[model samples]
Target: MSGAAFETIASLVRTRAGIVLGADKAYMLDTRLGGLMRELSLASLDALAAKLRAPGSERLAAAVTEALTTNESFFFRDGKPFEHLKRVLPRIAAARGPAQKLRIFSAACSTGQEAYSIAMVAEQLGLLPRLEVLGTDLSQEVVRRAREGVYSQFEVQRGLPVQMLVKHFKQEAGQWRVSPALRAGVRFETGNLLADLRHLGNFDVIFCRNVLIYFDAPTKSRVLSALADRLAPDGVLYLGGAETVLGLTERFTIIEGERGVYAPVVRMAAAG
Candidate 1:
């Protein structure tokens, strides 16, 4: 790809999604955008870059951004996070009134596995009615699939235990479908982490795992601070094992004895 074309696409992605794409990932432009390019009848990355630069290409711009996003997901990914959630959810529920819902946000919840996993945990604890799980991703395609709640055989086998599979899913035409009961407890939507998210309201638990590693330092700190603002004072934030708040922001502190679990730092009000 030409340097100009590469920078154009890279800038679009970074500006729209807060993801930093370096020259090392320049090769991905072809591999990832080939279908979009062909579908639009564009001959090369340079051509696609030109189309993207043209005014009123909002739809094309969105398509390119979604194409570049990594939607990799599976049920119960990195077992420890779900384990800690199961232990903590009931306690959080006990502190609230019976009618109050404990909301959990699964940010960048690709294909809905992480959100459904939370639903399964809530179901197992008989807390489904008392809880709500909202999964959001930048790609409208994955969000649609997640709302439909169907998974291929290969998708189910990835990190999904047989027992949980049998308990929560029913096979239809050789694919696993999440039970209506489980589906009812969760919702999926298309969202951008860098955009204003206040309308989504606050969350008692936020799972924003694995996506931050793709961002630059300033973007990471910005996102962390935004996440802190959305988190309840007592809420827990789950980050990817490799991601941390140590250098990014002081809005969160690691939960002692927990891997990947963080608590929002409470600010004290000054005396009158």
Candidate 2:
């Protein structure tokens, strides 16, 4: 990637995705955009960036965004979090009841693993009806793969247990695959955390783990606060174990159990 093109695309990404790619990330850009160039049958990264910046090129912009969006994920990536989810399930189910569903958002869900993991747990607990899961990402490519829900053996092996491997995924001609019934209540969409999430609908629990580190402090604060606003009063927020809500957003209250968790700070709406 040329210096000018790199600057332009990096600026566009930071503006659109809230990700700050440093000067050292030039090599990464070259490696990634090279693939994008080949896939689109384009001449070069410069041409690709020009097309991205061209008028009436929403598709090109989306392609660039998806190409640049990070897609790292695995099922039950962290054991403690899923363990915590199990304990919280019954209480959340009782609190939500039948009329209202227990909505969960896996923000930055890379390849449907987190959303499908939640679905499997909820179904196993007989809480699927109480659960409606949505997985979202900044990349159109990732969201599309997530909707597909097919994983290779190596992909499923990461953070997945042997017992679960036998139970949830079936061997599809030697490749591990998620069952259809387990995926019935999930949806995936392309969304940027830097933008308004109102159109994505409200969620009772949001899993935005390991994503904020890529953002600057101000960007992280703004994004977390917005997520807090969209959260239900009693909604729980889950972040990576290495991450915390302290000093970022006062609108969330940290809850400690097997591992720590964050819940929305409940406020009473004014009576008319």
Top model number, lDDT:
1
Q: After superposition, how far is residue 182 of candidate 2 from its true place, in Å?
A: 1.0
Query: What would the TM-score be for candidate 1 when compared with the true structure?
Result: 0.98
Q: Each candidate: how many clashes?
A: 0, 0
Q: Which residue pairs overlap in candidate 2's backbone?
A: none
**For every model shown, what is its TM-score relative to the native structure?**
0.98, 0.89
| Model 2 TM-score, 2 decimals | 0.89
Q: Candidate 2: where is the Cα deviation over 4 Å?
A: 40-57, 257-260, 268-272
**RMSD to the hidden true structure, all candidates:** 0.9, 2.4
Off by over 4 Å in 1: none
Please report the candidate that would top TM-score against the real structure: 1
The sequence of per-residue lDDT tens digits that candidate 2 reaches over residues 1-272 is: 67778887888778878888887887777677777788888887788778877789777666676677778899888877787888887787788767788889999998999998899889889887667899888877778888877788899889877787788778887677777777777888877788888887898888999998888888989989989978888778888888877788788878855344888888778999
